[model samples]
Target chain A: MSTSTEKEMWVTKLRKGWQKNLPVEKLLPDTQPAYVASWIYLFGVATLASLGLIIATGLWLSFEGASWYHGSNVGHFVNSLHFWSVQFFFVFMVVHLWGKFWMAAWRGRRMLTWITGALAFVGSIATAFTGYLVQSNFDSQWISYEAKDGFNSVGIGSRFTVTNFGQMLLLHVAFLPVIIGIITLIHVLLVRAKGVVPPIDAFNKELGERK
Target chain B: MGIFDHFMNLRAVYIHLGWFQISITNLIVVLGMLVLFGLALFLPFPGNKKKGQK
Candidate 1:
């Protein structure tokens, strides 16, 4: 392994990155602090699980296309599951965000983690908005008309019209999902790179500064 | 008591409390949001953070 002050090399940088930021013991910890048994700490994992369900049901929906989903009983069941999963994702993620914000989770060189998490929350809103616009129903049409004025007021409607079925459908299934996926990926990586932030009072324990 | 003859004509499910009435669906949504808010405020976190016992 290259020392911290060693001369630069691409391969050495990769080795140093893992050594300094993500040692295997920290990256995949088997034993969590006893304090980790609480429910709120699991919100991140809950949201992740909900996202997995959402994507799984979504792929099933995309495969069946709009006809089956709108017409068939089984498709409706899967759609309902997808809807509930999205609701769970938001509930868990928002609560998690609220918990982190109150805790000032940015402490301990974790600003990037907080930023990525916040961006993911915002990206989720856009993804959901496109999702509603692409629903292919009277409700969606009404929502598109209602939402267009707000987008126009912000000068974004001309570029991304909610009424454009083709554009909105593509955005919902492709663009927004991709953006959300990237943000979520970065957020998780940041959390892994910086080990879970301990409770403030735990700082008084044998916790040394992160190296 | 309401007439049983009109039972099949009923579509609106109402919960009556003295002077006020609300639909079951609206009640569920409102109560659900309140419950969610309460959970958000009081959910137990690691380190007993909710009670400052850490």
Candidate 2:
């Protein structure tokens, strides 16, 4: 009974500290509202949705057994879903990148957010490369040989083997996802912390012009 | 590395030349692009602002 009471007391203390550090008031934005946007703004959300589909389809494919995926109808459908997910992933990523570029979103203490996202984009390419190799199909074999030369030329062949199924699978399924997920979390946190930048005119106009 | 080795290495090019291979490759590429498009709906990349005005 005493031990349980002490545990409860510790929990209460932890809760109090959390409340003090992250009050609702502190979390609220001090700046402009975030809903301002055109239809293009929806692209980012679409990208995330596609990623969800990819993960779902990938899980289904993973359960089908490797050899089954190559010849079975159910496996084919799952593979199709995974394939389409990847296609949409790149499209959404490109659109989102282009949108961000046009917005000059790196300004006003938000530069690190932009840089981390750019790095995530680079990491995504690596993830995609591994995904291609893990297919274990004819194309996989052919691409592996072709890609090896490029990798070797860059001196990365010593450490990163494209033909290694175990390594590629682990990296694609585990390592890359963790990195991508963490970067995405950090990106979202930074956005929430900084709040959205107001319209350029809001900051650029003279004092007399201010409404 | 003689011309023969180069030719042997390029044997994969013949594989690409096959209609079946070409179709499969195109299918994969198209599907990949489609997936990227679908994803764009959700995880939008934040954009940069216009130049010189920030």
Best candidate per lDDT, number? 1
Flag regions of model 2 displaced more than 4 Å.
A1-35, A206-211, B1-54
Interface RMSD against the true structure, candidate 2: 12.6
* Candidate 1 ranges beyond 4 A from true positions: A1-7, A204-211, B1-54
- lDDT at A90 for candidate 1? 83
Candidate 2 chain B lDDT trough over 10 residues, lowest sum: B45-54
* lDDT tens readout by residue for model 1, A24-143: 877787666655655666779889999999889989999998656687778878887888798879878877886788778888899999999989999899898888877787779999
lDDT (tens digit, per residue) of candidate 2 on A1-211:
3366465677678777757744565466443355344444556667778877877887777677555677776686678778879887877777777767777878788898898779878988888888898898898888889998888899998889887788888787878878877887677666666665555566546655765
> What TM-score would each prediction reach against the true structure?
0.77, 0.67
Model 1 pairs whose backbones collide:
none
What local distance difference test score does each model get?
A: 0.80, 0.71
